[model samples]
Target: MATSWNGLSSVLPEESYMTLITALAFTVLWLLWSISSYFRCRNRLPLPPGNFGFPVIGQTVEHLLALRTADGIRQWMQKQVDKHGPVFRYRFVGYPMVMMSQPEGNKFIFQNEGLSNHIFWPSHISTMFGPHAVITQSGERHKLVRCHLNRFFDRAAMGRYIHGVNCNAIRHFTNHWQGKEQLVALDIINFFTGSCVCNLALSLEEGPLMYRILEETQTWIGGLYCLPINLPGFRYYKALKARGSIFKLLDGLMEQRRQMIAEDHVPEALQNDILNSLLTVPDEEGNLRQDSFIKDNLLILLFGGYDTSSVTLAMTIFYIAKNPHVYEQILQEQKLIVDGKCSSGENENALTMEDISAMKYTWGAIQETLRLHPVLTGSYRKTVTDLEYEGYHIPKGWLLNWNSQHSHYNPKYFKDPFKFDPSRWEKRPPPFTYLPFGGGVHLCLGYEFARMEMLIFIHHLVRNFSWSLVDPSYDGPIIRDPLPRTKDRVLINVKRVIAS
Candidate 1:
């Protein structure tokens, strides 16, 4: 039908023009392919299946944003798991990532001695936290730092510091509540937890500068959890600056501690806080690590320990206040302790390790809060070598993630997964079923310390006052990220509960 030259050109294009265009396109594609192929070949481990996006960025941004919510990304992952079984590959950013989700898979990945232990935090994060931070260190160095750090967090260590802890708690509350007409107990709770952790880390009391730094730093880290990018003027950038300023402030504190330790001017009882623990712990070679190592590691503990615990306690308070029955039950339990009729029957207010253990309902409430709103939605890892689990190949050089909420909410794992029922944890859900503090070798170092801190604050607050939502409009589920406060910042009307 197109025998004419014009018709021929319109239908197929001129041969000369088509040939030239095809050659140019082919050459451009070849160059792009070669570059991508080189990177792919260089990083030749069978990565866990993931969404591979545009080559350079891979799936970083997409992965970060998807995981920003509690269960949104996890629900998606569950759908994939349901379709692909326990192990599968999915497109992330633009890269293929293989993931293993079965409990056995988790065990396998966690137990393997040879699996590379590098972290997968963004460049900006690593830069701000410092390269040698124990969280990122690998091999023998990580082991040494972790071993020494564990000493400070163990029961023996914390037990010795109880007086110090009580002092910090009292000071934090008294200072916040002393002269305010309408005190925001939530923020006060936050500051209290922050001060508790600060005392643990640097043995320094929270003051005006420390509070401001804490506030600014919380904004910064909270911003990074959502906006994982570092474009200029971005929320993450501002947060990064805040983080740097906070680090500088911490540096000053660390220097002061070191000087005090050097001069033997520090209190004997409080001298062995995290910073001192690192400074005093000697390696097999009998050599002390430099001040840089001590400072970075202390920052790691301060950041990880305080931030997660404060958010958790805040959320628990939100739940307890909303469900007055739960609050009353906890108070009754506390009273039983006071009346020496605790379950196993212990004195009230003065919780022994046994009493804290017996407070199953309280612990369950914390678990439920964590399950519904994990302080961290996920954790990231980078493979050091090719690995395989649950029939899926995980290649080295790819970033992998453990999506916490999806695991926590999986109906197969927990009954009525979304509801805030603390009873589930009373029975103690299966291992890794509710990982608020993460799992495996990287399980949070400050877990026990956080628990003690939470229990102490909750015990005191529950005893002192009764509170409820102050504003009617503040009624709803808590909002997440960019600061995980209640929708209206958990504005609660407070009244001092008289002791009978």
Candidate 2:
């Protein structure tokens, strides 16, 4: 009986024992694979020094949170720069990135167009702008589109558009805020820019359709930096819907233009605006651009035109209002132009291209605003081949970012960098150090257009109104989604400057 019991105890189930051994073997194999993979990727060449915090997610949450406000972003970058020198490596939004804040780094990245291209935006941003848009295009296709668009923003073209820009500014002020006690500067400036761009780009009059377009564009802009999950309640999902709506609206508009052109309702020379130009411009094969290309490019222009220019205009107002001395100097500069017009028997309100050009001091003030509150914090480029910089090896297929704000606020580049001093611009900072409009082949094509719009608006604004911030204590925590904007939306008290 004892021998039989011992035999039973020794006969453990084969299936259970086999399962336990299999699990142990798999775990050991996984550990070995992970260890080898880690060792293989360890950089042989020294990378720009910085921490890649946490795995997978890797500094992305902190990076996005810092971008919620301008001060947060500045402080965050400053801290990293202090620790890691001007060039550093970090992981953010699923990319291994090297941030270059030094002027030499900026020059190398900007000048090496063949090695780097503007294809570094996340999935959500690329979807919003469309693959056909100029922002996403590279090489010969990019040059072709740029060449076509350049004709509309040249010196002669800007001279023609000045009247339209002036009219929009005057109408916005008069129709909306001439008698108002207080208004949100962001809202009004957005309206002003939307009106101006609509008229210039598509010849769309201020009406129900224009308002609809603006509404949809704002919704689309709100989603540019979203998480890109396509769930029902997600910001990116809503943005995708908004983009579809905009495409439909723009398609209808373009179709109408085509029909009008076919029936001879609109003449070729008379249709001199951007939409007309795009519709008529021929490709290398001498074929007219497709309607889809026209619509996509038009959307890019409209969003680009209104979003950046408006933010800069609003910040300029806030800065000027906060600093009495700055305001006084700007007022004096604008007044000189007004007075000169009055003396020359020119229309006091009508701003000509020559008149816009002569406002050098006014331009300085706008440039200063751009430097401090840059519309784009930074831009991204992707490496086509492995590159070396500052004794660091940046692998091919990695992303490189040149931070305009970091450079702008670097004490090494700008003395007393925090102070709002327009005078700094009178003597330009070193190249690539002050790239408010960006640099290289991908430099903003609408830069001149943006400058003219701001100048024209400032000319009208200072000449006619005296304003102050409603909340004097509100230093901006600028929220940058589609672009940088005030957290408070920039409320201000306004009174027309009655001519004595």
Candidate 3:
């Protein structure tokens, strides 16, 4: 009997084996069901024509990781537009990104539907920027902050800042370049612009604190754009820590500001500045919220305001040096305005709105600089609901990559896009074509301030120094880690122009 039972058992499959097989089959079925569900649910959206890409880790590999250079993102995006039509899907890491390149798509996102307000920043982004930062806000609340801040953008307010702006520019230039050769000119300019924004936005008394916060904020910003992996001692982890330090510092500043406001040390008139404005203003619900919002948001403004203007100024300086023809043209335009030849009757005594408006070419140069090297490679938005486009589906929770740089650099959209011709902007491009300040309701609150600061600083800078690059071949590869920094700090030699 025992021998018979043993032989039967040996021949029969073990219970454990059967159980293992069953689990495997179930897992396989579940995977298939999940994939099928994704496809079924995804195709329901009215999305533009595109690929779904791979499961989980999408086109993030190339968009963020593979392409670290300024032009790399544009090159990759152009290829995608060519292959997948104006609108297509790319996966970054596991995130599915719907890329839109067509004018109609751009219109839908930026101008018409008001999709530019969507803050598709990553989870790690809020961790650093805090929930109060402007990038984290949307809809009506964003409008509230923007409305209060608009007073700062007024031409009258800009006028008040001009004296301080010019003073800093002149002081920094004269102090830094006592005996410096022309080769070191660009670095001096960079330092001066950084200081200029710091002084104009936050009073000079808060300079060190603002600079530290700006540095920390930029590090966190770069890290937030990185892969979400939280391995020990990684760049992302360091960024997370830096973000904590930043918020802690901001919280302390907020408390200090609130105390000052409570004591009536801060006047109502000064409330128009970034700090006081947010403090005095209430949310839509009429609740007195925490001060974290003001400090963090102001911190964001400082970074955005300073970093972008500096980059543009640097590029403009480069163009002025490399292409002296453009420099002479800009100089002549300035001369016309100064010599009372322009429509704006104002002169060097006071820079009226009319006077600033007359320097059209100066403004054009700034636009062209941005066209060539945009601060942000692309704009990202995540779906809050299922949306359909052209017989396809974009499921809720997928990311949308508005590849603005691709459109900016495309030869089809821009004639000889790679060439740095400010004249291209002399005749304005389409509405959404030039979005350096971004668009929609979430358009940069500091846009006006930034433009004014750049215009004023550049006007003063170019008038004083004639600059040239130490090494003309220094334009090698730019690391797009924190707002398109070159591999080397661009060194320019500067000397007072001694006209022959």
Top candidate (TM-score): 2
Across 1-500, the per-residue lDDT of candidate 2 in tens digits comes to 36564465468577866776799899999999989978866845677799778886678778877877777778888888989988988987778888897788789888887555444687668878988888888778888888888888888888888887898888988988899989999888888898888888888877899999989998888887766788899888898898899989988988888888888788653499888877777877899998778878988898889878888898889888888798788788878878888999988888888888888878888888888878777778899987878778888888898888787887888999888888877787888898887788878889889989989888778878889998888776777765776777778999888741
lDDT by residue (tens digit), candidate 1, 1-500 = 53875655677757876886799999999999999999977766443443455775655565566555444456667777777665666555444555656556555555653366355666666766778787876667778778877887888876766566656665665666544445454566778777877777766677887687678767666665554567777777777777677778867866777788789898875666676766766766899877677766766776776677777877787788768889988887666655664454543434456556666787778878888888766556677877655544566676555656656777888888767777676576677666777777677888887877777677667777777766644545455663356655556666776643
Question: Candidate 3, residues 1-500: lDDT per residue as tens digits?
Answer: 35665566677689965776699999999999999989976755455655656677656665675457777777777777778777787666567777776555656665533352266677666666668777777667667766666777667787777666656655766677646775443345556656655554444333577667667755666675777767877778878877777768767766776888889886543544556556666767887656677666666766676666777777677766667777877877766666673345544634555667887898888888788777765566666776666556777777766556866877877999877787776787876777777766666666766777677666665666576777776665766665665555567777775321
Show the lowest summed lDDT stretch of 10 residues, model 2.
1-10
Indicate the residue-level lDDT of 390 in model 2.
77
Best by lDDT: 2
Off by over 4 Å in 3: 1-54, 111-117, 154-156, 182-190, 229-232, 267-272, 341-349, 498-500
Among all windows of 10 consecutive residues in model 1, the one with the lowest summed lDDT is: 341-350
Please say which candidate is ahead in TM-score: 1 or 2. Answer: 2
Candidates' TM-scores? 0.81, 0.89, 0.82
lDDT, each prediction: 0.68, 0.83, 0.67
